[model samples]
Target: MPRLEPGQPAPAWNLPTADGGRLSLSDLAGRKVVVYVYPAAMTPGCTTQACDFRDNEAVFAQHGYAVVGVSPDPVEKLATFVEKESLTFPLVSDEGKEMLTAYGAYGEKQNYGRTVVGVIRSTFVLDEEGKVEVAKYNVRAKGHVASLAKQLGISL
Candidate 1:
């Protein structure tokens, strides 16, 4: 599937969250949202990326943006990862990969010099109207949130 383009309406998703609650795109309809998709929970890269978001959540909030992480992990694992990392944002469970595929965050990608089919590290920023404002695929887990902050003109 092709990645979503800026101005396209973000796909609707209602997934289980780490807090044992549910979140959906519609629930955040009037706010900017950052939807980051990763391969797994509790892994090194995912941990670093999640923590980056957690650490800089205040900056995001100041800019009127809410952050959410999506992975194929179950809610139980996501809860554990959130608890262990002290993540402030919700970590969504996408065990079916339906939402990931809808956003074009799951598919073939180069991994360690070899092409593989799996979750493609991706991020999307949605405007207040729920239209995509930024769409990035095959993003590095490290320093990604910082880069995103820069893109959004948020001072470090």
Candidate 2:
């Protein structure tokens, strides 16, 4: 997988959101966007990460950033996750993993000391122009929002 780097243009995407609406990267054109990829929804780690993002939604907004979550799950599953977690941000469905692969979020990685191909638990912070300002891979789910906030210099 090709790793994304700072200053690289984020891959364009128009995906189905949990709210039954489509959201394109273009829709967030004028704002900083944080696109995070997870392996599955409603799982323990994913849930923790998602809710962390949810809890920090205001902090992200205060710093002029919009948070988005992406997963390989289908739309129905994404919707369920949002409803269950009361997530305020969009949970996008990437059933085909096309967008995931493009973002280098889906690829081979170490799992339990074994190599496996799956979602890599990644995050990308895009500038207003959609250029990547920060890129991270294989991040731990726990405390990721706080870490991201620190990385972006936002006060909790």
Candidate 3:
């Protein structure tokens, strides 16, 4: 799998969101964006991560950063997830797995010491110019947003 690297331009994307809306990477141009990919929506780990981002969304916005979540789940599932968790950010559906593959978030991964092919939890921070500022793969769900915020020098 080819993973994104710091300074690499982020791949363009236009995907359906949980809110019955469409979001494109270009739509957020000129602003920093945090694109996080997870295995599924509403699951334990995914829920924790989504809630973490939702909780810290203000801090990110205050720092001029927007958060977007990506997963293979359908729009309906994502919608339910958003409502159930009261998520503040947009969660895009990548049922085709094209975007996930482009970002190297899909493919082979180690699951409980076993090699498996599936979504690899990942996150990427894009600069204002759309170049990747940071890329982290195989990230843990809990406390991930906190760790990312600190890494990006955002206070809280």
Candidate 4:
């Protein structure tokens, strides 16, 4: 996977959302987008990360950002997760991993003392023009959204 840096144009993609909606990169063209890529759905770490975003959703909207979470889970699973977590944002299904690859979110990593290839937790903040303003990869699940909020200067 190629490492995307800040100021790079975010790659275009079309993926299925948990609500049975299809989301294309062009759909977010004129809006600020926060694309969060995670390994799977329903896991503890992923759940914590997603819940943080869920909790801070309004703050993100107030800051003119649209939040989208991407994972390799199927839409049905994603839907269940969203419903369970009461997540209001879009949860994209990257079952084919194309979106994850394009965003450099899928790759090899160490898991439980074993080296394996998998989706790396990452976040991309894109401007209204689709240029990446912030790229955070290999992030810890705890307090990450709050950290991102701080980085964006969003109070609460």
lDDT top scorer: 3
Candidate 3 lDDT tens digits, 13-91: 9999999999999999999999999999989999999999999999999999999999999999999999999999999
Estimate every model's Cα lDDT from 0 to 1: 0.93, 0.95, 0.96, 0.91
The Cα RMSD of model 3 versus the native structure comes to 0.6
User: What TM-score, to 2 decimals, does candidate 3 have?
Assistant: 0.98
TM-score of each: 0.98, 0.98, 0.98, 0.96
Q: List the residue pairs that clash in candidate 4.
A: none
Q: Write model 2 residue lDDT over 1-156, tens digit each, in one string.
A: 798999999999999999999999999999999999999999999999999999999989998999999999999999999999999999899999999999999989999999999999999999999999999999999988899999899989
Candidate 4 residues 59-139, lDDT tens each? 899989999999999999999998999998999888889888888888887788998899989999999999999999999
Worst 10 residues of 2 by lDDT: 143-152
Higher-TM-score candidate of 1 and 3: 3
Off by over 4 Å in 3: none
Off by over 4 Å in 2: none
Which window of ten consecutive residues has the lowest lDDT sum in model 1? 82-91
Evaluate model 2: give its TM-score: 0.98
Clash pairs, model 3 backbone: none
Clashes (backbone N, CA, C under 3 Å), per candidate, total: 0, 0, 0, 0
